[model samples]
Target: MDKESNRDEGQAGPVLTRRGFLGVAAAATAATAGFAAGARAATPGKDAKGDGGVLEVAIIGAGLAGLTAARDLQRSGCDSFIVLEARNRVGGRTLNHDLGKGYFTEAGGQWIGPGQTAIADLARELGVGTFPNLWQGKMSMVSGGACARIESKGGFDTDPRLTHELEEMAKLVPSGAPWKSPRAAEFDAMSLGEWLAKKNIPPEEQIGWATGIALSGGTAPARLSLLHWLSMINSADNIYERLEAVKEGAQETRISGGSQILSIKMAQALGDKVRLNWPVLRIENWQDGPVAIHTPNGVIRARNVIVALSPPLCNQITFDPPLPPRRREMQRRWPSFAPARKTAHVYKKAFWRDKGLNGWIFQPKGPVLWAYDNSPEDASFGVINAFVNVSALPSDPKAAEVELSRIYAQALGDEALHPVAYYDHDWGKADRWTLTCISPMPPGFLTTYGEALHPPAGRLIWSGTETADIWAGYMDGAVRSGHKAALNALHAMNERRA
Candidate 1:
């Protein structure tokens, strides 16, 4: 959603009953009417003062999902809600790195592209400007320890034969109901490596594809599921080019003030209703109303809740009566691999562009898998970003810097050796609230347990990029999910009264 990779499988939920489904359909009208009337009070439990002492809603995680829900509720004249967040800041994956000189770059999620209209619309509404990604010039291509310059003609460097084959496979895996595909079980059973191995692509080409997979999915092909990968492709219009290419593809554009600003703006509108550092430790009484959310700041009771956090982070909160077996299993078996780190090498000028290079660098054997020109639009300063998984690299920052410097110099000559300033955020190391950068679904994880990704686990509704129906791992998908979760919470809560 934020990046072209469509990274993260951060969603999990359970199926609801027939009555619940009917209730959702029936309560939609009441929820809308309630919102239309004046409901703004900004306190969670005050709804119960006169009407049974039950708060209307309690949302967790002040990221895009939670913040979007809160903002929409505010707009709907519903203030009987509170957004509880564990971290001191907003924007889950979208973070900005101040690079000085009136230029700031995104350190986390911050990209918009073809068909990613949700985020684009949100940015436009929030008064955030957007710039197309610089994919115009010659890019440095590294393969088997050698580097060469290659130009982009709006086509991927991948083989047409390989790309076409994969694209055909993608058509079968619909974005909304990937599990319903006739070959779902077959694709779900195999890892990307096994599937590629069957295709018998040459080793060098395989290396290229592998790097793309890692950049696209935020994990290596060997660890990702063929089904999940195909589904992501489907989300991009069943075209492999839409998922991987720059022109008219997912890596098309970026927000001007960094993607995080969208959430920041949303939170600003909601005011203090968005509470930071209020990490929910436990959720009690979900089987009935007045669900108690225990946090370090104490407990807050609400009639409905939306856990708009990553599926794994959902596991961190102790559920009083425990989630359903399938939902629990979803969190238990979900793996957090390749926690990501992004580094922006800020320079005095765009030296790479002077050399006719667009600042796109792809390293096959890398701690920095994909490096590109992420310079500010003003071109006032140059910023080269390394979107990488530093799991196997050095732990120390200086040591890591030295290694990265060496790698950049090898690709961009001596000018790349030093930076005016280096801004990096290792979500892997720095943030406890964001445990995994993305969830690359492994073999059999979806089909065997895909049904758990929708429906509410009692009053605890689940949402995030990963749970999105269309662009499940992208920022657009995250926004779409937020809207959906808000509607679900509204509908379900109103259903109780009926």
Candidate 2:
């Protein structure tokens, strides 16, 4: 085995943030310790590709990245590409669960800000449908069990300094380019909590919003670099302007049937090019020419390949000679943003709606971080998706359901409806990809490893929601990265023939 492949075979998960872990440990009721530690040892598997004519390119992970690459490749008139997906489904994070309540519920990514992100544009191009989430009634934030309606309230920030600090910090960030400012970059190096401390904000309010952001990033806030925060702010600012330009509200849109509609459309548009249930077990790059992908079914020899997976997974793919020291170091420095685990429950009704609530509860303590009213507008059953904050939940279906109910009651109210069925997939526990979200660097991470994250390594050009320049975490980001990778691949193909 090549060093790259051997490294992938012997690799471990991202290291946890020390201070961040301590903070969360203090408040987190459930823990995900030893989750990845127990993953099965790397097993060799057959390649899924057939002995058909040599493929010009193979795009792995048919989610948004692979699908976007396929669509763009088709547009560029490149017909010799194939999309391989591990799961039977196509949409990577744009997943929805049918809890048998009303309509489909989003288990992966469900929100669509008016960011005009590449995914949004692709949806429009593919004629995928969308609608505004009817986040009707009021939203509330709960801390220390105190409930206050958000709209008519000036909710207290435990520390007033952090609020001003973040706002002032926001001003230093240029309107269009967040990555350009050295001042901004400096703040990006520190943890959000550390930034608050620098601004003289107390720990209480800082931690509350810290919890909010950690939940938002699907990783703890303290572990997130301030740079990531600024990048996010810049993206949100772009989104804000687009919404204002279009006269839309922050109560934004979602896929009509679900985001997966876009995935389905992209896959269908690719015709026979998309291969489902084809998991890429190993990738080898030879110095002479061509890259080899090993799957369960057969080997696929391609002139080039787009990894289109999270960095954590990238670390899992073995390279023949080995990735450059800098790139390998970049992978080691950055951490995966995928959550430990998440659970979505299907309830019998939109029970929280009856109480004039949208079921958005921010808990400073507990396993449930955020819950949403995912009930499809036209469904009979009430479907809701909850982001389970911990990874230690047993794999048993019944146990997960019981734990979810307990979380709802504690975070929201005792009146929160009991779910009839539950659905969950642990992104972190998956051997291939542990992080549910994308890879995010610490404060200096982007400054130190930003360039390395984008460098096309081996035959492996990377793309995913995190690779996007504008909307890095959302589905839109995934589409952007795909378009980018396809362009690079197509250019290489043309140059090779030229």
Candidate 3:
């Protein structure tokens, strides 16, 4: 077992400011206390029920969305609820690769920036701190076998005029419902790649745009919907840089103690109300009150069921009476191809910083899509995290590590070859539950099946990061969806009593 610690000390580099230091200190203290208190709480039990042998609510998938909903229910003085997770772990998408000795590098959704108040507020409530992503020095752009150092404060060097055009187009699309946009048909008719091709963007400059969209949307621009991309930009306040860049962007700040800790802390507080390894195989009688949830363990009845899993994952659970045709078709067609692969290469120290490099590497023709310094706030050890092209890299972990190390050595110094440890997490192969890391909406997807995403199917209320109105496909969106789902459940329950 890896040892975990929340302490943040011995700051290095210009990564953390004075305010960041204080924030880290306070968060560490709060998190330490929270963990201790949670440990003292009652141990998690098998099941939970109300006086009527049925729960008021049953939340499926113990990810950020479901866990947040469970926490909200507890806060609202409601105990007739239980959280059922398919995996043995509580966190759904958010995971941490424990590096032992109180340090951890995030393996999944870890960043929260300006306008992402939902997750920011949740982190504060959970006593978690945050720090800015390291992007202080020159970034390396590697093509073919040559490497060029470029000055990029925001970690990207895309054309300013093109970004402005994208931002303008994004304003017409609503973050919640891209299909409702005035230019929905026109925008949805074309892919991002097509739009860029019309502009005759230079091949060199196109790499930046492609890398950004691929990292966020989980596919090449050729397959990504322009309307969906615009909606994502709208989520970042109709600012292309805010959506793509690290400085004042969606990938700006990282949560303390890893993003998964928020879900962990919430599950701890919920205790026995949270059930792990309880995959809901079927949901019966969902069209009426008192729905029956059939799991591997047993049948659990609930008045309201929060289907907090992603749209594609919902296809796994059999709806006894069948779901609405539109909703059913939406789930069946939901894009789940973006199961991204992330790797972390740990070193004795961040030697790249001394070479006037921020540890940011962008390879256009290589397996490394984007690699950046993911070292801890204190900089106790150097951790270079990257989103890699899975198909290009070796299948074996050790061989992949060696290939990546060689790539890093070319960009950074030869010191990259002497990494102490390497951690690789392929979301596609990690588990059956997570079909995709991010939902890369293809052209025409939103216009065809988006309306059915938010609406409730009988007693089952759809809730997940993808269901969020503002920051869908983000951690903030997951929390926002959770809040909405919990409120919906509470309102339905109250209406029944009335």
> Which candidate wins on lDDT?
3
Clashing pairs for predicted structure model 3, backbone only: none
Tell me, what's the RMSD of every candidate? 9.4, 10.3, 5.5
Candidate 3, which ten residues in sequence have the lowest lDDT sum?
A: 10-19
Which lDDT value does model 2 have at 199? 62
Q: TM-score ranking from best to worst?
A: 3, 1, 2
Flag regions of model 3 displaced more than 4 Å.
Answer: 1-47
* Residue 88 lDDT, candidate 1, scale 0-100: 61
- TM-score of model 2 vs. true structure: 0.77
Model 1: how far residue 95 lies from native, Å:
1.0
Clashes of each: 9, 23, 0
Residue 484 Cα positional deviation in candidate 3, in Å, after optimal superposition: 0.5
Give the Cα error of residue 197 in candidate 2, in Å. 2.2
Residues 343-409, candidate 2, lDDT per residue (tens digit)? 5555566677777776665555655565556666653555555565555454565676676666566
The TM-score values for the models, in the order shown, are: 0.88, 0.77, 0.92
Overall lDDT per candidate, in order of appearance: 0.72, 0.58, 0.81
Tens-digit lDDT track of model 1 for 1-498: 011111122210000000000011123223222221222333344432324555688899887888887777777767678888776667777665544333456767666678888888887787667777888988777655588888865445678887788889988998867888899999999998887878878766775687678777777788899999999989988878778766787877867656666776787667657776678899999977578988877678888898898888888989989999998898888767656877767677888888888887777666777788888777876778877547645756666666777777777878887776765567766667877766789999989778887878777888888888888877888898899888888787678769
